[model samples]
Target: SRYPNDLARYPNARITFEHNQGIRERRKMRVNGNLLSSYQRQTVCLLGGVLQSEVSGMSLKLESPDKQVVQVIMKKPIEEPLEGLLEVVGEVTAKLAVVCHGYVLFPPGMSQNFDMETYNRLVELMNERKEHYPTMASC
Candidate 1:
């Protein structure tokens, strides 16, 4: 499939494919060093819980630990029946950027935070709530 031109509005931008069956994603852009060095991948890991919530329910509300500094509530994608996993990821990332006002944080120690526990938890959670995921119109 051809890449979407709308993504070209941002330089160095690449399409990220969030496969429905797994956490691994195929990135459209080339990168040096370990691919895991990429910020997008790390962001995806950190937001696993939040994303799961969105997929499981009508909306997700994120807040800081203290419930003061940060608070973001996101409704499920208005564009229902996403084309596929690619579209699902693209829309999720776009909405996340908006919620963060485009200034995302990547703590130095966070990349490896997508440990087995977190991954397994996400899988379990998503599986438990599979029926709530948006319907896919077509692949």
Candidate 2:
């Protein structure tokens, strides 16, 4: 992309802090070198556990331990359906599911980012407490 006409150019003048320190460059590097390759596929990771607690609109990423791409969300996409999520646990063959507010549970091995153990545990905990029927939705 060419520089916008609105940007003023001064010969031998220092650019703003963004250009001087290469913050954008570094951020791009971090995204490409570390997060973009595997886990997140260069996208942001969103954790289910974090989304479950909110009562309002929000956005977050669920990143792996190694900066792998996982999941990204600009806002809470759906409502969490808290059901007998624990009953499914211990069933290794049982498909892993992702529950979102205003959404339904999604089978595992489908989503790029999420922690199995943590998510499962959280499901079990939330299932025990949630009473309202969540609207069916998917990842």
Candidate 3:
């Protein structure tokens, strides 16, 4: 029953199973190959928990592969009320991918809006915490 050798004589079944299976196999191979290539190129960075605020957006720490630590704090001013604050934060976090090896990776049409002062304070804070995580290279 599983083999369905009897259906092999039908042209429609052959087209549905054989031709489609070939396409599916090719697609799977392409997907697996792409995944392998991406794994080889990209370094895995540890994204820490996000600390949210009402005035500003959200603040989260990213530990790069090189052991450097930097906080990816958002610099958006809250113009609207807290109606869709969560949605806004979600959108930002989804699009924002910080590369811990040393920098942030912005998607196409996206630009940096980082708060330098906050980053400086974060650097100081990270330095203070370095006493606990001696292995980490915090900025």
Candidate 2, residues 24-107, lDDT tens digits: the string is 222111111132333222211122322232334332223323333333222233244322111100101111221212221233
Candidate closest to the true structure, highest TM-score: 2
lDDT (0 to 1) per candidate: 0.28, 0.25, 0.27
Residue runs of model 3 more than 4 Å from their true location after superposition: 1-104, 108-111, 132-139
Root-mean-square deviation (CA) per prediction: 16.6, 20.2, 20.8
Where is the poorest 10-residue window by lDDT in model 2?
85-94
Any idea what lDDT model 3 has?
Answer: 0.27
Winner by lDDT between candidate 3 and candidate 2: 3
TM-score of each: 0.20, 0.21, 0.20
Ranked by lDDT from best down, the candidates are 1, 3, 2
Q: Lowest-scoring 10 consecutive residues by lDDT in candidate 1?
A: 82-91
lDDT of 3 by residue, 1-139 (tens): 3223533343222111222233222211111111223323232223222233334534434432223333444443333322110101111122233212221122212112333345445544544564553322111
Candidate 1: list runs displaced more than 4 Å.
Answer: 1-110, 135-139
lDDT of 1 at 97: 31
Model 2 clashes, total count: 19
Q: How high is the lDDT of residue 125 in model 3?
A: 54
